[model samples]
Target: MQNLLSNLKITINEKLYVKDPETSELGRKILKNSIILIDEIGFESFTFKKLGEKIQSNESSIYRYFENKHKLLIYLSSWYWSWIEYNLVFATHNISDSLNKLCISIKIITQNIIDDKNTPHIDESILNRIIISDFSKTLLTKDVDTENKEGFFLVYKRVINRLIDMITEVNPKYPYAKSLASSIVQGALHQHYLKDHFKTITNLSDKDCLSDFYIHMIKKILS
Candidate 1:
């Protein structure tokens, strides 16, 4: 899988950036360091000036790629979902059984992420942490509806749609496939957050992985 992914480029919404960050050395540096910086200080406290300082570039140079930090956050979120969608497709494409395919999809979506050596410019493990912690901020805004119409959240929605198709395949009669699919994706992040900061309310721990809990819950709901 790593070998397969190494050759592919993860696509994000072109509208999210003023320039393609993967196209040039400085652009790639911006992406590479932005992830590290955001992971270190978080989105609220993160700024292009800080990223410029870290990258040893002028703040104006950062703006050449992104209009502002909010757009940059949306770019990162879009890239993360696109990567997940690629992994989902590659991992489940050859599976013949619906249940097994759905189970693997759930695992891929819910399991803790690790750095993929294939993508040297991006640390997916760190990006996953950002997604778990700050992804909702991208959507819980007054601009969400307008952005939704502009297709800003298309990749994320596509991931849920893939799961919805898989759920329907497993049980064609299930009427709440869309609701369940969205819940599994969003709830995985929520559960992970709770496990990290509010442990008393969540059952997930070292002994029980998030994937196992969701898999069990999904199977029960579908049955």
Candidate 2:
């Protein structure tokens, strides 16, 4: 499993980074530690200097891989969605039941993070927290249009597209497959935030309850 995971490369769009962090030891450290630092200190407080101090590298070296914290944030988000797409394909590939496949997809997307020994460097639990809290900041920027042109969001779009395909398969006449897929993804993000900051806003009492909530909502919509 370690060998397979080490071999597995979740590629981010080249446009998102000035240098590919996955290609070098220091680059990998930057990626790994950046995730940790970003989760420790919110993105607004994260900087290459802090990351450099944490990883015992220079800020200029960090800049070689990512032009700025914003680019790094997008790169992280893209890597996450790429990982999700890979798992979605792996998990649902042979399932014949449409609803079952959808349920598995929900589980994969909504379930709380569990660290895989195979990927020792990435603490998915922390990364998931970053995603839930900071993912929107990637697009809620003035450069969103410019970044969109560079395909910085393609991997995320691919995940949504894959989910939309599954939804269409289960309900051919459903007119809002795209909307519903986006809702499921973003809704999960929002609920995670609410669970943490405004508990009463969402009934997602615990991480395990998330999958149940989304699956039930999907069933109601499809019914």
Candidate 3:
């Protein structure tokens, strides 16, 4: 991890020393502490008071970055999606084949979901946070104050758009390229969760029966 940080031009100092302003430093500290707290204490158990004690900051300082636990959770959920976008885009950029790009994109996303170390509730938390954004309730409650209520959903929409760009060609035979790509992504993700969450009945892990199913769905859509 230290080597990776160094490679990214991040110094491996035991601590951050921006010396810019207390709020700036506190923001980083709070985020780091929140991540650790979420991992160790579970996000549901995480509290601003506890975070302040862990990071040696007051709750007021913590509120500067995130007004509440839900807002912080929103950040965490969106961060994962942003990370998925970064990794998938990077991994598929060198591949010249459109079909390969689509395959690679879905595979990377599935692998990410399966490989994440967070607890199952983290995924649930993501959906809850997205729901607030979906209905603009986060802004309605005066907790999060983004000018555009749909900012987070826009990120998801952009990901779907990128999938289209990667999957569809300049002169494609498929009449419904974008919609097909959306369906393929939706099927792969939904099937993965359905199988995992209902493992008792389905006896399927994310990709245990999913890869073949997804490929068939893709073929049917493309055909």
Candidate 4:
């Protein structure tokens, strides 16, 4: 973990992608493994030995990147924030209108149309994985007992706030008085994703229901 963190700092400051490929590879593996580890096994059951076995690396190597389970989760959550930000970078700068930009970006990030011909829709298991190891909630609030000195939380907030800021900037008339609204929107979205049933209904198996509902909701919020 020490070497990986050092490599990250150096890479950031020095702008050298050529350095620390091993550390970089390890980081990628950790991120991928973390998705499965957290979502499938849950946090309590996840272990470095299992992670190492899954990734075909030594337990010591996994330990070298993450000191403990909490650190490992934080690392994965932080990387997830970065991943989403990186994914949306092009969308942020692509359109001139913040409304369109936000709409497009949200579609990309919280994609509807699970059976869409274009994206092939997100896998049910993968969606479960994400919800279980949620990137959004962890970024905003800490579940751990200790105060989060690590500003990885900031990185997560930046993306969410950027979206909200874009919304606020584009729609001056829209009332967004409550800071809690952001969390509300995120929580609503998560509930829609995690639950198998649509609200009180159990027979409705259509996957696009929530996606459509979210689109309508976003449109209502933006308009």
What overall lDDT goes with each candidate model?
0.93, 0.87, 0.54, 0.53
- Tens-digit lDDT track for model 2 on 10-85? 8788887889988888998998899999988899999889999999988999999988899899988997887778
Report the C-alpha lDDT of model 4 over 78-174, residue by residue, as the tens digit.
5444545655665466578776776666665555323212212113335334543454444454543232454535555666777677677767667
Quote model 3's TM-score.
0.61
On lDDT, the candidate that comes out on top is 1
Would you estimate the TM-scores of all the predictions? 0.98, 0.95, 0.61, 0.66
| Candidate 1 C-alpha error for residue 216, in Å | 0.6
Candidate 4, 104: how far from true, in Å? Answer: 1.0
Error of 1 at 76 (Å): 0.7
**Residue-wise lDDT of candidate 3 within 25-74, one digit each (tens)?**
56656655566676666555779999889987777766655656765655
- Model 3, 145: alpha-carbon shift in Å? 13
**Model 2, clash count?**
0
Clashes of each: 0, 0, 0, 2
lDDT score, candidate 3, position 20: 17
Better candidate number, 1 or 2, judged by TM-score: 1
1-223 per-residue lDDT for model 1 (tens digits): 7678888788888889999999999998999899999999988999999999999999999999999888888998999999999999999989999999999999999988999888888899999999999999999999999999988999999999999999999999999999999999999999999988998888885555789888999899998
How many pairs of residues in model 3 come into backbone collision?
A: 0
Superpose all Cα atoms of candidate 4 onto the true structure and report the RMSD in Å to 1 decimal.
7.7
List where candidate 4 sits over 4 angstroms from the true fold: 1-27, 112-128, 131-147, 173-181, 197-205
